[model samples]
Target: MKALILKRYGSLQNVMFEDISKPVIAPDEILVEIHAAGLNPIDYMIPKGIFKPILKFNMPATLGSDLAGVVVEVGSKVTRFKAGDKVFASIFDLGKGSLAEYAAVPEFAAALKPDNLSFAEAASVPMVGLTSWQALVVRAQTRAGHKVFIPAGSGGIGTFAIQLAQRLGATVGTTTSTSNMEWVRTLGADEVVDYKKQNFEDVMQGYDTVLGTVRGDALEKALRILKPKSKIVSLIGPPDGAFASRRGMNLLMRIVFSLLSRRIIRLAKQQDTHYSFLFVQPNGEHLAIIGSMLESGQIRPVIDRIFSFENAKLGLEYLETGRAKGKVVIELKDTTI
Candidate 1:
């Protein structure tokens, strides 16, 4: 099996293409022959050690989460899929990632890929799709007539979130560069603020929820646009105590996160709005629903570019530029047995 393995956490130079043993599966898992892998900020962040404290990984680990491929083998307890099934998933197990020829995924995290999508397109959906679903549906409880604001409307998560929010009956608002304003509008954002020309905080107001993919001052500006009792879900964050407790971090780490998020949490409280961090998790059921939506044309993937597996490093570099209009993917040759 060939994989993009990280020998140590540091620069991109730490990553190497190497032959590794095929992944072994547990009773509740499936072995997927990956055909394509999606690249996200976390792909680079992991190797840079940015998430070391929360998502510690062993040396020589693979570095990807979203994948689309065929199931080569299913564990004893697996019931939803079998050999030859086309599936996709965002695997959360940091050790067994999708940037390899084969990956072992929990059965509950793998869903049948939509009939209408190619492997590359399906691979681009899992992480960003689930992030939008989790932030808007699970966390914010967005419903019809609600106003939802999403920053970076042309990026991976924003592209998906805008469409999903509109599908859920929310009036979607988003920020993008002037060049991408008309493009993002096709995704159904009711209000498109050209961030390069106008500030989103000044133009948008009275939102029921704000999905924050950009943090720091961008997140603060988002906070100011919300009405009282609104919710802001941040994906980039100084995570809150609840997140630390959910991940079952040590007391010291928990305290660290508590102190890290204290100021924002207090600010949110003072404004009578709620702020919480979201870490998207994998769920086969949710992916299944999203797949159905794709099948029905309720949501469409926006792919910025596709790189060959050999150029996976370049794909990550492109994503880091913060210029991709949508998702970037790495396509692998299919060699399923």
Candidate 2:
């Protein structure tokens, strides 16, 4: 099988196409004939040695987090799906091998693709879609009539967050550049703040939840927008317990988190708010729920571009620019064929 392998962690130049042995299925896994894979920032970041503390990987590893394809073979212990089943999955584990022509994914992390979407579209959903779902529904417990503010609303996760929040009857607000304001509105954001022209902190208020996608100082800004007792969920690691817990740092991190949380608790006393660091886990059940939403036309993927399999490195470069409006897909074979 052909795969894009990283010989060493660095830039796009490190990614090379090579023939590699196809993955053999584990008892709880299924071998999928990958049709398309989604490119995420993590794909590029991981090889640069950013996530080294959390994920230990061997060199020549394939890098891709999401996949959409047909199941070719099922492990003996896999009862959830069988051969010929079309599936979509968040393959964040198992060596991130979705960039290959085939991949073996745990049965629990793979869901049947929605009837309404194409393979490429299905590929785009697992990571960002699940991130939005987990942060809003699972962590924040966002409810109808609640107010949610999502930063980077025109980006991958933001696009899904805006649509899902709106579908659940939440009043959604988001920040993006002026060029993306109308696009964010189309995704169901009730109020779109042009980040380039105005300060969202000045005019936005009373948000029940603020979903953070950008890191560093932007994350701190998100914490301030939430109403008293409201929650803030961020994907970016750093600050607080989530990053420490994820890194498997020592108990010192626990003590640090305890002290930092006390300060946040004090702030909440003044404004009545809460905060959490959300790291989305792989859940096939959650993917199924998203599939239903797609089939019902309640939500749709926002795709910025589709590159040929040979051009996956190019897709990585595109994502690195931080300018893509939505998901970027890499098709293994031309569907028109």
Residue 234 Cα positional deviation in candidate 2, in Å, after optimal superposition: 0.7
lDDT by residue (tens digit), candidate 1, 215-292? 668878888899999998999997999999999889998999999999889998988999999998999999999999
Least accurate 10 contiguous residues by lDDT in model 2:
260-269
Which pairs of residues collide in model 1?
none
Q: Each prediction's Cα lDDT score? A: 0.91, 0.85
Best by lDDT: 1
- TM-score of each model, paired residue for residue: 0.98, 0.93
Candidate 1 local Cα displacement, residue 259, angstroms: 0.8
Query: Scored by Cα lDDT, where does model 1 land?
Result: 0.91
RMSD of each: 1.6, 2.3
For model 2, how does the per-residue alpha-carbon lDDT over 174-224 read when each residue is reduced to its tens digit?
Answer: 999989899899889998889899888878888898887886567566666
How much does candidate 2 score in TM-score? 0.93
Off by over 4 Å in 2: 242-249, 252-270, 335-337
